[model samples]
Target: MHPALSIIVFTTLSGLGYGLATALGTGLLDPAATATKAAHLLALALIAAGLMSSTLHLGNPQRAWRAFSQWRSSWLSREGVMAVLTFLPLAASAFLAIFESRYEPALGLAGAALSLVTVYCTAMIYASLKSVQTWHTPLTPLCYLLFALAGGFSLSTFFAAMGGGNLLLSSGLAAFFVCLAWIAKLVWRNRMNTLRPISTPETATGLGFIGKVRLFERPHINDNYLTNEMGFRVARKHAVKLAALSFGLGGIVPVALLLGLLALGAAHPAVAVGVALLAVLSHITGMLVERWLFFAEARHAVMNYYGG
Candidate 1:
């Protein structure tokens, strides 16, 4: 359950990159349109960078070629397949956009749709794991997709504000997504808080004892891989604090800044870009901690042996 930075960066980066690509493919990018080309390009770059980081997390990077072999049964395989396939439409559409082809918008739409599927596949990689009861829910994938888009769109807003002094669209998008992500997060957290493990010490031991069974007559003196891996625990009060910080820094602050800039008609490049970066950084940081707590907070089936 130890949080790995490589995994964290991989997830966070891919989430942001592909998420932004999702919106861009949906006509968010128009050379002759409202948004800027620079924003679109920046998003594409980030997406590529994120995917690269994610790929680096594999144990045998060379054997990563085999990842796409079992899409029928594996979410990770599906994610790998979908993530790679997303690039075809993205490249074609981006090419048309840059070349000013009449068919660019259509291509962009196709890519956007595929990008969304890619994100869903990535989310499902975690949600489909039935062993992790805390993550075994429809909301898990839904939350992942929503947060990625929220993060992507927020990054786009910053890029757009820098290129064109328009705060209205990004602000509106940020505010709306903040509310949606918050609600989804709260729903997941509350559901997790109420759920109890289905296993017990007796079940693990097959003693069939009917009376009160405790995990320890004597305390555990040695820490092993199981305890180190699955014994991670989080304090409720600290979790609340982290959630509050995430809501404020990741959710509230960026929207407030955008709104403020809009009100004053002062969407300077620096301010807009700064806010956008801040939003991306804060949101990703919060999600990182959230993901950490997510793994740490879950009580594993093996814990029944320890009377957890």
Candidate 2:
């Protein structure tokens, strides 16, 4: 499982965008406030950017539209469909906030629900893969959803601080979600560390009775698509270091910043904004490392035949 930059960007940006949309949908921010408007615009931009980046992974970007037709059977297709459908309510909510300067509770709620559903669909695209044991767990979607909320809260805190809203409440919310996100991630990593693969070379070949199966020769003299994509290997030591870094930057740092802001209480607007911005930046950077690890750490069952 090679970590593709396109998919990493898609997941990170879209998750944050949808997270912010979810907050807005739930009336976490005042619709008429300038901060709300900025948040909405940022959400839309992130979503658009993420959706577009996904096409880069396709063999034919122009034909990506065909993916929408398989929603009945494919999680990827479902994600595509939901992502598009989510835009309707999201756009309406944004329009109402910008023009009417009023929050339509119903539309906002619907948008929030749809935004979460879209992120869930995205997570399912990976979680539903039976071949990837690490991702084939309920925790996959849990981690995705929690991280999105955490990132969203962090961003909202920044917006609130800059827009002269109640920093205490927003920062508190951010801290809560950050804690949940880290907890979920820690559980996910634990599962990955201990879970046994249902597939092994011996089991895959139906020759376990013979015992101690091993690959004596390369499948080919040179690398092929399968080897290049599914046979990627990461050193255990490097993984440990990256995981620690991810936890620190993505989870610990953001939580500390939020809690610090809360403790400081009515600090200068510039100082508050700077702290919130740093939290947002650090969280995003941490998420990038985590996403890379998500792909890099996975051992596709197909690799079993290749002695992975």
Candidate 3:
């Protein structure tokens, strides 16, 4: 499918936002600390920005509100509903953290669980689409959830380092999550590399019993909406290069920095904070590239009719 900039930004930013919010909900940071207050504001900003960006891909942003009506059957609608519901407890918890300087176990835990459910719903938006073989798998949601945790904990490590909290522990969690996310991503990519098209030209036309089906004439003289939106293609070489870059930036560097933070034992607060910041930046950039590839590399079964 065509890689839409709005969706990419939406997923990447929201994933990070939800992840960070999850960390806060779990009471991972000291509620009374100034850094915790800042983190709360940051999480809200990221989520709001991402949710807003998501509307850009819609043909009519004004009608986007209609998406909420299909929650019974639509993953997209479920995501919208969950996103709004998740924001409530999260915002309330943030309010308490910022003003009252306290963490309520019930609110925090509720927000954390809801935050994860929202992310799962978002991933299911793509994973549920049977037309796209690349995205139709259990691994899709697994990668999405793992990446959210990895990025969330990495950002948490930065705040923990800034506040002089348990920097070592936060960094250790960050490193562990980063490792887990990358491993899952590697497995996902391998599946993409090996899986054959479930729907080919022959199967699509139901002519496999007779002979191979080939496009003798163009479907249209000019490109149509389906061709433009669902027929995007990417070269294998560029994909390999981008995949390497994503793994390195989004996974390896963050893990290394976080592991180093663990080894330092909170001896150098300033250095730890700086390193944590770099890891967050690198991880975000890497995930952006990964999200791009996630869309670019996907092959929609509808393309078989278009001679894709």
Candidate 4:
């Protein structure tokens, strides 16, 4: 709930990487193009870098190696494993695209699938945590998937615009998908706002006498790890303002620019590349705020004891 910068970087960077891989698989990147492959590989490198940096947030870097051992029950482990495995096919495809021609498409397709799986695993890491009612929903996974797609589409628009020619088509597609994702995001936000907390103080404390329990004493004078991690609370009005800013800057502005690019028949490289850069930057930043509020706004049963 405190919103680790490492995590923010990790998610946004990984989103970009995964999105690129998806575009490659979907033929949006045109793997036959040498420039496209080069750009994609570069993006993948950025993703790997972000993920590695995120690992530092863990208490024990050495013990992080043990994470891969529990893929059976842990979404985090699955995410790590899948994240690493995805690189193999992606690198291989990039290599083949550069050196050999025959097997590139097949390898690219495999990389794309692996990338999607990695993203899904990451999504489940949050969605599966039942203690967090706001995150534990079917919509969570869908949101992650859509975000990945939207982000990927945004990247493809830039890459294509830069290397090939006009980005009008890709920008149009990005705008369309972004709008759709925004709608879904709104639905999710509304659902979360209206949803009741999964537990109450009495249930957690096992004290059956409950008409309403208000905080009678301080849990601690100073914040402990749990309080720091889970006790984050934001004003409703402030959250609404932030959400509006995120939606407008991240969603609406980019789409409007893209549509304008199309209408004006703007220069190929500038229009496409500009939109892509702005969209990814805005969206990723917005996602950071969103993820932060997501954890912060959640009402834990313990909070009721704190008179939340």
Supply every candidate's count of residue pairs whose N, Cα or C atoms clash at under 3 angstroms: 1, 0, 0, 0
The global Cα lDDT (0 to 1) of model 2 is 0.90
Q: Report the lDDT of model 1 for residue 153.
A: 75
Over all chains combined, what TM-score does candidate 2 have? 0.97
Per-residue lDDT of 220 in model 2: 87
In candidate 3, which residue ranges exceed 4 Å CA deviation? 235-237
Which sequence of candidate numbers ranks them by TM-score, best first?
Answer: 3, 2, 4, 1
Q: List candidate 4 segments past 4 Å from native.
A: 32-35, 98-103, 208-210, 234-237, 264-268
123: Cα error in model 2, Å: 0.4
1-308 in candidate 1: lDDT tens per residue? 44556666667677777767766665553444334555556656766776677777577888888988999999989988887788888777666555663236677777777777887887787788766677888998777778777877776666566653345666567667766877898899899889876666777777756766676542557877787766666534486787677677766775676566556455356766676677667777777776666666666777777655
Q: What is the lDDT of residue 98 in candidate 3?
A: 95
User: With candidate 4 superimposed using the best TM-score fit, by how many Å does residue 304's alpha carbon deviate from the native?
Assistant: 3.5
What C-alpha lDDT, on a 0 to 100 scale, does residue 12 get in candidate 2? 100
TM per model?
Answer: 0.85, 0.97, 0.98, 0.90
- Candidate 1: segments with Cα more than 4 A from true spot: 32-36, 98-103, 164-166, 217-225, 234-237, 265-270, 306-308
lDDT of 4 by residue, 96-120 (tens): 6556632366777788888888888
CA lDDT, every model vs. true structure? 0.69, 0.90, 0.92, 0.73
